[model samples]
Target: MYQYDEYDRALVFERVAQFRDQVERFQAGELSEEEFLPLRLQNGLYMQKHAYMLRVAIPYGTLGARQMRTLARIARDYDRGYGHFTTRQNIQFNWIELEQVPDILQHLAEVDMHAIQTSGNCVRNITTEAFAGVAADELIDPRPLAEILRQWSTINPEFLFLPRKFKIAICSAREDRAAIMMHDIGLYLYRDGYGQMCLRVMVGGGLGRTPILGQMIRQGLPWQHLLSYVEAILRVYNRHGRRDNKYKARIKILVKALGIEAFAREVEQEWQHIKDGPAQLTEDEFRRVAEGFEPPAYQGQGDDELEYGSHLTMDRAFARWASRNVHPHKVPGYASAILSTKPGPSAPPGDLTAEQMEAVADWSEQFGFGEIRIAHEQNLILPDVRKRDLHALWRLACEQDLGNANIGLLTDIIACPGGDFCALANAKSIPITHAIQQRFEDLDFIHDLGELSLNISGCINACGHHHIGNIGILGVDKNGSEWYQVTLGGSQGKNSALGKVIGPSFSAEEIPRVIEQIVATYCAYRELDEPFVQTVQRVGLEPFKERVYARAPEVEPCAI
Candidate 1:
């Protein structure tokens, strides 16, 4: 919700004009496809399998109702009549024309939005917890800091073409909803003994060809040095990070090669010079950025007349949704509602139609404040809905395809646009996702299963976040045929840990059965009400691996 100032406006406008010219030249045949590749990528345009995909950045996944309406308009006017919300809390239009992208950028700039840094090998959009400001358990609101980092990194001269794309996440709560441990840089905001805000910094976390959990670099860093510290880390990575091999170019690879102790030492050596410099935040600058994200005025209303318990007594479906989708807010009467984009038996995860977008915007305005949020799990959030309107909102949402009632369930999957759209994909991920959804259509069964994140990626790029899922599935190609490798015990929470592959890969056709076997093993081994993650950690992957590969002749019984 950070508003653009004059400098911000001017920079975006100039970039739009520059891209407009570049697009015009490409259309006029003045620029070859090879020549236009990087330019188009820098502008967030990708020539995908079907058409050009435009990824528009929703900074920290916060947007007002007006901005949501504009995005709906863009989906209607230009590309297809839908958009896909991604795992990074950004939105992508899958069928955009090459020539109309400049116009799309112009439309985004009109409302202080842009697709810049949404793609290419540079620092991408900074993500934070969706329930940042309103969450009941937060040390500090992280959006202001996320916004500050966004400005500093946008078109940064030195980092424009880093070895590979960099991702940063900030979390203020203990739950780690933003998947902080899976980012290139993760900052946890906390108050020290003196009640002053400080950041605990972690670096080198990523999920790609090589997945890693970030190592702690600095603890109890004063908030004033956030930007300068980040600058030092980036400078070190830029100067010495790998560039010869694309696969090992990420900061994670560098950190692994140098070892955590040496990397921490290097960052500390670099930070000693810049920690208290001009890039360090001042009180006025912090206040200026914080001004845009101050909580909206709310009336102090009691739950006397409200039917908080009555709704649960009246409707079972509504009760289930309230339990899963609704979250505790800082305010008494208000609650944050998460709208699941991974509706069962529909399109792949995060695919939302234009009408759905408009409907969400309207719902945000009607039931809550005129604001919305995008979660990192590819879901939407109405962060300020009242408790009284919960049932009505659920009913309306059910009418639209938006309501799936599968938050934190087995069917609520995280999958990438694999062979269907992505050029680097090894297999078709959507069909596999549909297959799993169909296999797990029983809601009661899924609810009883409890809090399992199943993530699938078509390849090792790990765009679907397979490395962080409780059950991770990665697609691989064997002689032009698709096979899947399954990993278990991964989690992206307070106790973050990477998943371990169960055993040998399975044929694509056998994946659903493999998942069912794993789930069955979990059900058998788990104690009363133990989640899949907990059960897996307690019993280890041995039991699940044995059960899953029991029937497969090709599977080898080795831990990943």
Candidate 2:
């Protein structure tokens, strides 16, 4: 993980002091809510249903043991004993008191972390592949580029107040685990034919009221021009992006309105003037960032036979967890273990209790590298666990009910804290997710369903990425009643596609059955080992829709 330099520390602490003053003024009635909104938002504080919520950025979702321990401390001492990990790899404390935010920020700064750009109409957290450096299939480590972008975007005066909040994700692996297609700016780092590293820029991609897969604007762009090119895109959007209506403010909306060709032309025209400017990265700069991400010291056992295999054979439960939770590591005789946050009913998706956080911190060092990663799928990753230690790590994970073997399964749901926490949510998301999770708690049955994704957002904002889940669920408000809408055929990857609505929204009580029907339909039509998504595409939404709408009413559906 990249350690903060003096300049970085100064900036973060200085910002914290400034925010402390802002909060003081707002409390003293020196600043109105209107005047204080932007300031608080810039600091990643939001007014939720019960109290303030503080979102702390886990930049590109990388954290060391010290940082993780600090986060656990914050959760234990300040807010409730748990924090919610978001899809963006950020963590949110939902019960934050307005007065203690400064203290929280100070504590975060102490661990080289901050809440900057986690929210508001600016470049949010610069996310990348969670297993960037450790993925065996990676072309290059995307974390350095992600960190460079993070530094470039942080407090970049030109983009601080864009027309709308912008999100950027970088991916280097063949699999698009970062959901590159659903970001305001998606950069896929790859090597060209000549064997030089470059970026494939995709712009105008986002999900909300309007969902659009990013269009490829620039391909084979030299990695050195990353900052310059990003500046050009932001400049174009800032100058022409709509300001009149918040709904039409995202860069994706602007890109859609202007067509890819014209948009690319404008960005190119803008880039020509600034291509060699101060922002153009230098070889030394790349070296400096790359040094921080050098490969960890390995034991060099090279896929040797180990007790881990014996343990797997002896313990069915451990084997089950290992099969789904463990992923291949770049280094030999090592693995990347996913600690599932989705334990069903007991814990909400992407949530961790203070004790659990501390345990994970201990496990990160005890198992592999002294670092942890938060995947876009709302799971925590121990990036380089030695294969021999899988059983021990699994035992530690099982302590907090985090040993569920449901990664990428139907019960491994991606969900947002809807009406339960978010003020903007139309319905309660956690309860519904729990309801569905309880209905499908059978691990064997869930595995039988095979490689499924179900995402739920409290509103059309798509915070849960409901637009990209194999089965997307959105909470709707119909005459003050909580209704749930379902979308199918959505996925995130090379073949990313937005989900299509099946029918009218169903009530909370009816949603679990609706999902069951959809699953049954997929199981009936699937051939061989085809995944749920392939079956949906092959047979179209008609089969699922027919089974779903049989009980659905004629009411209009929520346009998620």
**lDDT score of model 1?**
0.89
For candidate 2, write residues 254-303 as lDDT tens digits.
Answer: 99889999999999999999999998999999999889888878897754
Estimate the overall C-alpha local distance difference test score of candidate 2. 0.91
Give the count of colliding residue pairs in each prediction. Answer: 0, 0
Error of 2 at 423 (Å): 0.5
* 398-511 per-residue lDDT for model 1 (tens digits): 888777788989898999989889989998788989999988888878887879999999999998999989999998998998888999988997799899988888987898
The lDDT of each candidate is: 0.89, 0.91
Instruction: Name every residue pair that clashes in candidate 1.
Output: none
Best by TM-score: 2
Q: Which parts of model 1 have CA positions greater than 4 angstroms off?
A: 551-560
Residue 143 lDDT in model 2? 93
lDDT of 2 at 292: 89
